[model samples]
Structures are given as structure tokens and as C-alpha cells.
Target: MWIKKFTIRGILVGLVCVFFLSPVCMAELPITSSFGWRVHPITGAWKFHSGLDLGYDYGTPIPAMFDGVVVQAGDFGDGYGNQVMLYHPAMDCYTRYAHMSGVIVDVGASVAQGEIIGYVGATGNATGPHLHLEWIVKGEDGGYVYADPIGLWM
Candidate 1:
């Protein structure tokens, strides 16, 4: 009977540890910065703003959100202007940065988290100088879906 109780207690303790550690393992964004806020700039009115606007002076350096290979980097010409797409296999995610004044990384290049990848600016459809960052999870059908950037930061 004592051995049975000890085994049950061990299992309970293991379950508790797994429950607490799962989130930490899945949570992304190991770095913190003075980015992200709730404000609407596109509509010129207060709306549920998504993503972060890393406001720095024009030509301020922008960094990679994670270690990834630069899959696309150039003028997309569809209101994204100078854009870059990084593919992170570990996270199974892709990060896009739009409206860059200059793109520093080239296609097929590997970049580390927090490494400068470009410069923020008012390009394409932007009304002011800022970076429009987006995180996307690739769907099974080769389509990409948007994910909340704040969730990654948490």
C-alpha cells in the first residue's frame, strides 16, 4: 500500500511539472523591446490595433525576430515596399517586416534573433515612418495565416 501511494504521488508530481513547463517551452519571443501598443494608424481612428510599431527615427535599425533564413527580401511592390520574409523552421513560422527604408539582408542568408535585418521607414502604403511586422503560420495547403505578434512576445 505504501508503494502504491508513492507511485501515485510521483505521477501526480510529474503531471504538475509538465503542465507548468509546457507553456514555457512553447512560448516564443525570448527578447524584450520597447515595441507593441494598441493604436490604430491605418484607419486614422481608434481600432483594435494589431502587431507592433517599432517607432524609431527614420533609418533606425530593424532586427530579426528569430533565427531564420531570409527567404524573400526586396521591394514587393504591393504596398509592402521594401519587405523581408524570414523562415524559421524551429518555430514553424515566418516573419514579415514591411515598409523598410533599406533591406540589409539578402535572400538565402541566415539571420539571428535581434540581428539587424533592415531599416524602418515610410514606404509603400505607409503614411508615416514605422515598421509593419507580421508573424505567419504556414497552413498545410501552402497558405499562410496571420498570428498575433503580441502572443509571440509573451
Candidate 2:
């Protein structure tokens, strides 16, 4: 009797968690470049595409793909140039907008989904004006696992 009861209860709980706790993310805009291993445009060598590049004109506004707090926003001076990283607490995931010409949001700023946070630009190690997006899953060691945002879809 105990085993049967626990099995049924466990299944029910698992289903509920899947419905309420995990949410699938959708594409926020048109894609210019997809994610995955591809021949690099600049280097002409096979490399893992870390983010989704959205096509937009120079200075085109880029909206937040989901609700989150702005964790970092500024000229990274890294290869990404001006970027914005948003932390979604509910999902424990981060979304980075890279190669932007300018950022409107600041660190600790709360932004709703679809809110414009920055404009597209070819800053840093970029070829042209486009928003390079990256989705990062928070890891246990206080680090992050870069993921394909398209895989977040339901």
C-alpha cells in the first residue's frame, strides 16, 4: 500500500513541477545568425556559435527576451564589446546581448520582457551591426553554462 501510494504521489508532483516551475522561452525577434558550430565569418575556421545574432540596422533597439534584472551593462572591452547580461531569477538563467552600440539599462535594473535595453551595433570583435545574443544557465560552482536559446523553446 505504501509503495503504490508513493509512486502515484511522486508522478503527480513531477508533473506539477514541470508545468509550474520550468518555463520554455520563445524567440523574441528575427534571427540573422543561428547558434551552433559554423565556419567563422572573421576567422574562416569552424567554431561553436555561442549566441544568436539578430539582424537589425545600426542603432536598432533590442528588447529583453524575458523578465530579468540587469546584472551587467557597459563596455566589456572584451570581444563582446558593449553587452548587457540579464538574470532571470525564476528560471535561474541569464541572457546576454552582445556587440551592441549602446546600452540603455544599468546593473540591477529590472526589465520586463520585450523592453528595449540596447541598440544593435558592431562593437568589439564583430563584423557588422547586429545583436549577438547568448543564453546562460547558472551552474552550481557559481559559474554559467552557455546554452542555445532556441533550445529553451517548449
30-132 in candidate 1: lDDT tens per residue? Answer: 3222233434446565443333444456787787766799999999777778999999888687878888999999999998877889998888867678777
lDDT, candidate 1, at 41? 48
Look at candidate 1 and tell me the lDDT of residue 152: 42
Residue 84 CA error for candidate 2 (Å)?
Answer: 0.2
lDDT of 1: 0.63
The CA-based lDDT of model 2 is what?
Answer: 0.73
Provide TM-scores for the models.
Answer: 0.64, 0.72
Every candidate's CA RMSD = 13.5, 10.7
The positional error of residue 95 in candidate 1, measured at the CA in angstroms, is: 0.3
Q: Best by lDDT, which number?
A: 2
Q: Write the per-residue lDDT of candidate 2 for residues 1-154, one digit (tens) a residue.
A: 0000000112123212332244323444457787777898888999778887877789987787677999999986778999999998977877899999999998999998778898899998889998897877755455666666554443
Consecutive 10-residue window with the lowest summed lDDT within model 2: 1-10
